[model samples]
Target: MGEVLVLTAAAGVPDAAAAGVAGRATRLAPGAIEVALDRPLPAGFAVPGVDANVVPAERRRKRLLIADMDSTIIGVECIDELADFAGVKAEVAAITERAMRGELDFEAALDARVALLAGLPESVLGECYAERVRLNPGARTLVRTMAALGAETALISGGFSYFTGRVAADAGFARNQANTLLVEGGRLTGRVARPILGRAAKLAALEAITAERGIGVADAIAVGDGANDLDMVRAAGIGVAYHAKPALAAEADARLEHSDLTALLALQGIAADAWVD
Candidate 1:
């Protein structure tokens, strides 16, 4: 058999019909097939006649998982839920959408959004955290599998601690770092603590976690969906953009487009079926 070339479309392009073409080409040795395409390929579709062992070259044996919270671990931005509490979802969400898309300055957008929450009752924070936030589908399975493999997990977010703390516990992260919101007199003071955790801080969290664990950075994987996560995403040995913005998807080394968080396990050579729900 001849070597089969694995092909993928560009970052955003996914053509089922073209993939059918690639699929037929699988008559060649799968190991010999090099996927050269402009966009992402179909999920879970492997070429025939190819040795599974040789098909995936960049197999990850990760020791640490550094995940972003908003739209990654969870379904929605925690901060947007917070904005909903104050009935400022329209105003804050616009800025948040821009910031997450890498269109606006992160710090400036955050400052503007937080400023709008000024004077919202402190109780609203709990309401948003308690009722609004939910783990993204398959998040638990992903975390459990990583932990079972003795990989340490940390949640590093540009989001606030008010949400990340609870999310970390629920998602089973070993450590978490995020910005702190300032509240006074049971109302938002409309300010975040200085040295706000942004892209740089997200990268630092990975460094700190790796240093404390005595693991090399090559054993780490980072996943996120926003522009603020670019620095750390690039820093990780394996970086994934999960349902990310166009810019983020363009920059990430790999992406999860068709499926949920469990799709990530495939990159590590761990199929999702082997993992318990």
Candidate 2:
């Protein structure tokens, strides 16, 4: 079907209007706006208070979505909770805070934190996954909406694959990718495998997923909440930082400080009431 796409110019970096095209213009970012309409837009039309340009909507791609797990899809930090299980919540949380804030080196800090959990029994991993992890509000609605729209979804995390795998299963993701926690004799070995998944790994996952799906980067949307997520979010057509760290929120293509994951549905022309949870 013919349609109109209102996009922002890379140079202009326009702001969103108080009300979107249909009613209120939702701000996707400093330079992006999401327009909702029942039909194709008239030529040269512009929504008042919103800088809109009309383009063929069919040209827009609709496949490949990459998302981060901890803090993005789920409300809690799986590793920190695992620390609590290991009786080192205070120490581990300190390092986690620094890493999330981009103050300490991520790879090194991750190693130190995991080392603290060295003697932790493998069973605590399941305890943390079961007792601590909860899906972020509206996460199911967001992922289901994307799948219904024909987008292939994947969950990538800097956290361990054990947890990411469970989250992916519960959240309807097509695949899951994450770091593996080294284990020996039913306890953490205090070390992670080489080529740890950090900023570059996250971005590379986006590229790999898109290529495997035969889709362009512009067709994908990536979401996350830490310094490590910056590269992936920036590379996708729509990169959202949901309740992210301050630095991440500042750089993301879209910021969701006040809303849940459901806010993303608006970007794809799905209204809140119409959203399927």
Top of the candidates by lDDT = 2
The 0-to-1 C-alpha lDDT of every candidate, in the order given, reads 0.74, 0.75
lDDT assessment of candidate 2: 0.75
Clashing pairs in 2: 19-24, 19-25, 20-24, 20-25
lDDT of 2 by residue, 211-267 (tens): 888888888878899888888988887777777898687787666665566656544
TM-score of 1: 0.80
TM-score of each: 0.80, 0.80
Off by over 4 Å in 2: 1-62, 272-274
Lowest summed lDDT across 10 adjacent residues in model 2 is found at 9-18
Q: How many backbone clashes are present in model 1?
A: 14
